[model samples]
Target chain A: MTESTLETSGRDGLDEQAGGQRNSAAPPRSSRGHRFTSYDVEAFEVPGGREEDWRFTPMKRLRGLHDGSASATGSLRVEVDGSSAAKVETVGRDDERLGTGGAPADRVAAQSWNSFTEATVVTIPKETRAADPVTVTVHGPGRDSTAYGHLQVRAEPMSEATVVLDYRGSGVIGDNVEMIAEESARLSVITIHDFEGDATQVSSEHAHLGKDAVFRHFAVTLGGDLVRVNTKVTFADRGGDAEILGVYFTDGGQHQEHRLLMDHAQPNCRSNVTYKGALQGDSARSVWIGDVLIQAAAEGTDTFELNRNLVLTEGARADSVPNLEIETGEIAGAGHASAIGRFDDEQLFYLQARGIPYDQARRLVVRGFFGEILQKITIDEVRERLEAAIDEELAAVGV
Target chain B: MATLEIKDLHAEVETEEGSKEILTGVNLTVSSGETHAFMGPNGSGKSTLAYAIAGHPKYNVTSGSVLLDGEEVLEMSVDERARAGLFLAMQYPVEVPGVSMSNFLRSAATATRGEAPQIRHWVKEVKQAMGNLEIDESFSERSVNEGFSGGEKKRHEILQLDLLDPKFAILDETDSGLDVDALRVVSDGINRYRESGDKGVLLITHYTRILKHIKPDYVHVFVGGQVVESGGPELADELEESGYVRFANKKEATVQS
Candidate 1:
């Protein structure tokens, strides 16, 4: 399909990772408040930035998603590929399976739930394989308008499939995404947000995994003025494994944040969360918050989360917070790492000394910085698109 | 023949207490086809002179001037100095993550040569240089200096000196960490560079071990941040037997006087 005709959501993309962090302290991702959830928008109050969950976020940039003044003036256009690969349905709000993946955990999420007119649900049935990745393209209303959207994807028992949720175009938006993997199912979901420059999007995504299920989610954020994403994963039974991977690049005067939660509620469950981000230009900021909670009943749970940020220029900033709470001491490995590093000066000097100009040298180092994450995305088209986006970002700054 | 000249150069480094002087009022000149070995003790500021000339950001030049064939050397940025045909083989080459050696070397070659080298020829050139330095072919695919042993990093430095082919090269304790076998391999690489008879070499070392292989024409005794004496190659033999004690005491006596 051509880039212009496909409809996609303005799911403004943002993603996050960490490495070699505090060895002594337990994850200090302090629990300022419980992750409250509800379908009612009024259940949550406007966040004041002092809330632990909202501290690193700039409330003023949320553009009324926090205050209730922003209402959807336009609708999101979502297009699901042909029916040959999987089952696709455009269901209204009253569908029984609509909110089964998760409930709205924040004001923007609850607001999106209350406002979106309809939701799109896709399912890969039992013992079937999705030969080609099911592509769901979502296009925004326009940069001048505001919109809300919802999407849910399901992987049935004994099935295997890959879903690509491509969010494109522009608008000020809020949305909710739900994902579920049934018993013995393997599901891979890759979400790409390549929005227009002026777009602002706030999204909440949740994943539920069943017994012996494997669910992997990859989030790629290359554009957007302000994109804040809250992603959570929960296990419904033992032997459930989930891997959350994300990569994001923030340009000048942009703000990107990723808040992730891994809840090991079932015994013998395993989860790994890794997110990496790069920020360049003046006032470019990236924030990552990782929280791992191990309940008392959960035993033999293996979990590790890492968030790493690379600040590529003088005026850019990165904030990483890793919080780990364990209610039971008898469990498998559990740890979290968070690190924010400046571009290595010596690395630049070493390359520059070899006669590479300042701009070219910076590009080389930045490419190498993201190489680790890009290689993990085995999808050819997706990886190429990511590389092109990064190159464009580098050239835009003449670096 | 191009001449690398230092006239009354003075530089300092920032320490915890305050700014502390390192190189104090030093002057020397090196021409293509001549190897000048700077023999000194630990902390005698030998490496500082190399870094100051290479335009490392950490060293501040308080006074004096460095000239590359009558042009201002101190005014150029690090990369510009490199393009101007000056190279510094660092004692501690830093590890740059993610960038493979092949990519880095090609980019550097492109910058110095003012165009990307023809890929077909560039590949052969790199392969030949790697073989000459005894660097395994795998290293070219690995990140620059990452996880390299001391001996391997030294050999890698020499490999660049062979490939970049600068007009004037600064050897900043490149011989410090190598084993005897690796030292011979590195020295052989340096000797091959000088065979062209159009490159000036400033070989900095504390011991005379490397001098035996590279064979410097001029030897300078560096003590207390200054070159107190310069003589023929025989000075290296004398320093090797007697060490830097006499030169150091002479500077202390002069300070007291």
Candidate 2:
């Protein structure tokens, strides 16, 4: 089940990378390191918006991250609060546990990997369940420059813990996040991107799961001029489970894109992805791409992914794509669905017929759309804050 | 004491062939404490008249007026019409995902009553109405009309009618898809609303089975978008035995001539 054997068996070793412009005329490049092991910044060339993995992304808005011209000039304050059962350390790039989760798959991630001065590593002790969640706050000082950040979180065997990454303030940032869940461990990560109006961010997150590990990742993207998040998951052993959930709202002149890849490399693993978004105003755009790959040896794989988008006004666009690639037909089950649509006219009419005004009816529908996903968040405080944020977004749109 | 008066009602709907008239100068009047049955065959514009009275945008009132207690209903928007004391039990209830039935009902009550109801009383009222309609308690938590059966939807309509307590209610084809048991439950709910002695019921249906439970004070034989015959309760029995064949033949003759 190694990468070489899988490639030499006549199957292409190159995984399908979204947003990259295809250059079919060029000769096929040799297989890079294993799918999740390549980390050299020089390995990936600067993208010109033509690569399949960068096509939907506004390259110019990236602030030179793709071209390696964006340097770490502004500083971001990082603070972590962990309990007695957890250990925290700031290690250099040569730390042994630096790249256990995965490597950078694209240029921006590779740039982030090479530019970070120090990496924050948080680990939970074996068989120890933490009562309090580990909170990591990354605050920008509203500087007009670029910066890089790297954070690694590891849940030891038979341990259970929750981690929250809170990002706020202004400036341009490129961040890399790695998470590893050991055997029989349960880990949950909540990432909140609450940037300022002029801020831009390009983040890549990688997660690896061990035997019978459970991993849940929740993302809330509300503010930013341009935000792109690429998250990938790989199974290190069998019986692992992953659930990826996201909720986003985009207003005028905002561009938000989320791309996810679930690689089931081991047997009897399962993954589920559900992401919902709402967009309003002119030039408000959102994109979601969900990709699941089940290798030949990954038998008994059960996976399903769904994405739904609601357009609240004119001049807003939402693009949703769900892709599934299976190398073996003996797997248990696999399915994907995506829908991008405006408000339902009949639903509006029905509500109005019941004596509810137009504005109230619209607000109710929008709240209900986001509430379905927000209710799945296990933390009560975080769920309430996200709901309040959604209300604010609705009010901003004059709904 | 309320009255719904329809005078020279002429309405049309937009079709592919352009504006096609549905109701041609129809006149009707129903005062408080009266139940009027509009009996007609399929495609006879019975439902169109009901929808027109409810101010559905699809139905255009070319010339005529609907007056609720001397207030012109045609000049008001759909929601305004509801707040002004008009209710329509749609033939096909729409499903609104993720909006719970309790929330929708409370919102509707607030809009119509000019303020939010007391929670304790509202809960008790809902429980009583649901019990009378034989609806399961779990339905309160479910989305409005989402995954509801035909009988369940009809019962929910009656439940709204009982709670909203509008001056006049236009039940369009409310008995179309109900079984015997469900028909009894729905009819009983309507009768309870009528027992208030100040509510008017405009019952529109194709069959006479529902009439066996809820008696109509007047029966009107509707055809060619107008009421051609009017009589007492015996009219329903006659139409049930002979059907609308005579009215359809007469309309066809008049059109040909």
Candidate 3:
């Protein structure tokens, strides 16, 4: 199909389907106050075919997400490391941007929104120093067929903190997190996306960087049926730095896509991104798109982006596009690279000649492919957990 | 006892003209516990001979056979030959990312034993081997020669030879990039492994510095893709003192005649 034709068809089908449901009826509301936003819920619908952002997504997956009449299931219990885990309390819901899961249309259209209730909003006080990493384990039981989670983080000025967010559940978890860094603050966020069988997940993170502040985000995706994650960052002041790193392994009909948007709004700012993916098995697909925008006002901007992928099977596929849209010519340098390739036969032969069997040879390749990203995790315990989880995933994929 | 026998081996590498012969009518043998060094100048096909014996796909054997322990190995895949106790300390060891040195050695050792090595034994043995080579324990955790200096990479190859104890090991220009200390350490590893009476060694090099530490039982001069002279260790001394210029001139003379 022509690219344009596919876009139009996909958008048209999504608009009609999602739009109709949004305009239809408001289901009987619970006593809980769910603040309705400005736009009609349906108006917030993403045009499947016409939208460039939604092009590669399977529109069918978003069906019934906006239908209030859609059945809701019991909530799953939270457990961490096999013990009862603290759940993310939803005190209030941002009705519009609640995601396709019955989120009011206006909220979804806001582009960027943060709403919550009874949730623990972790705040690092100004000038506070946290040497030991803080661990947040999110527990969700697949009790409900659909669920929503919202988390907020704020790092005060001149403060330093490390947060590890672990996701463990057997249900579709739609989570939205918003973080803001105060001037001169440093924040490191490590997210581990791991869920059980029969689960679909979608998550979005939005962060605002302050002058001279530093923000680092690390994401590791190992298990999910159809997982999509989006991270958007905007540097509001100058002299700040941002680093984003991610690694994803897909196999056994799994599909994982990560989209990133980095806006360099001020001069003397720098941003970097490196994401690597390994795909195996039949029909497994992974996509990575990084869109970096340098605003006209931002002079002396420096940015570098790279995406590398390794295809482990003939049937599996990976696509990477590092897109840079710069508005000024005064920038120091703006560059991007996207590389996709297969296993190195010479490296494989070397490993095997060392006496590593075929299966172990495959593992060595994967470990090497993901080693750098894993090292970037920063948090030792979390890194170990991720390593164990990756091993489990590799075994499940029959690697 | 293990034995390596090469019988009338003929091989070639792909080129514009298609399969230019690199090794023609070459024959040699090294029995258990013997160290044989092959010397030659550039373009003399020294490395090509090493690769052909190791079953490198790039060098197709037009004819001839390689036998390890009296079993034909010319037909074996590279890995198959390795499993049959053939090891190549490459002239240029390929850099493998993400695969840690320790994990790689353990896996290789396991494959050699036809079963997984005991975890404790592996850890101890690998650490001891690395220590003997003056390699830090952390080296085992680092990716296999991913960003190692030339000397470090060569030492890493010897580390593997220590851990993956094959019946026969071929060191192809293994001493080229080593510093004085690294050369000694590498030679020490080879000498230590010589305790395994049945192990044979093929040392392919242009320089004789490595021979000062690990004496070879036999030395051969390769010219025009074939070994033109074979003698005792004194052959290495002859090449070291006078160099391969005469041999190169002789090959040119032969090619013209």
- Candidate DockQ values, in order, are 0.70, 0.66, 0.47
Q: lDDT (CA) for every model shown? A: 0.85, 0.86, 0.73
Best of the two (2, 3) by TM-score: 2
lDDT of 3: 0.73
Residue-level lDDT of model 2, residues B166-200, one tens digit each, is 99999999998898899999999999999976889
TM-score of each: 0.89, 0.90, 0.72
Docking class of 2: medium
Better of 1 and 3 by lDDT: 1
lDDT of prediction 2: 0.86
Evaluated at residue A349, the lDDT of candidate 1 is: 85
The number of clashing residue pairs in each candidate reads: 16, 13, 20
Off by over 4 Å in 1: A1-34, A82-84, B15-18, B118-121, B249-257
Window of ten residues with lowest summed lDDT in model 2 chain B: B247-256
lDDT over C-alpha atoms for residue B241 of model 2: 92
Give me candidate 3's TM-score against the actual structure: 0.72
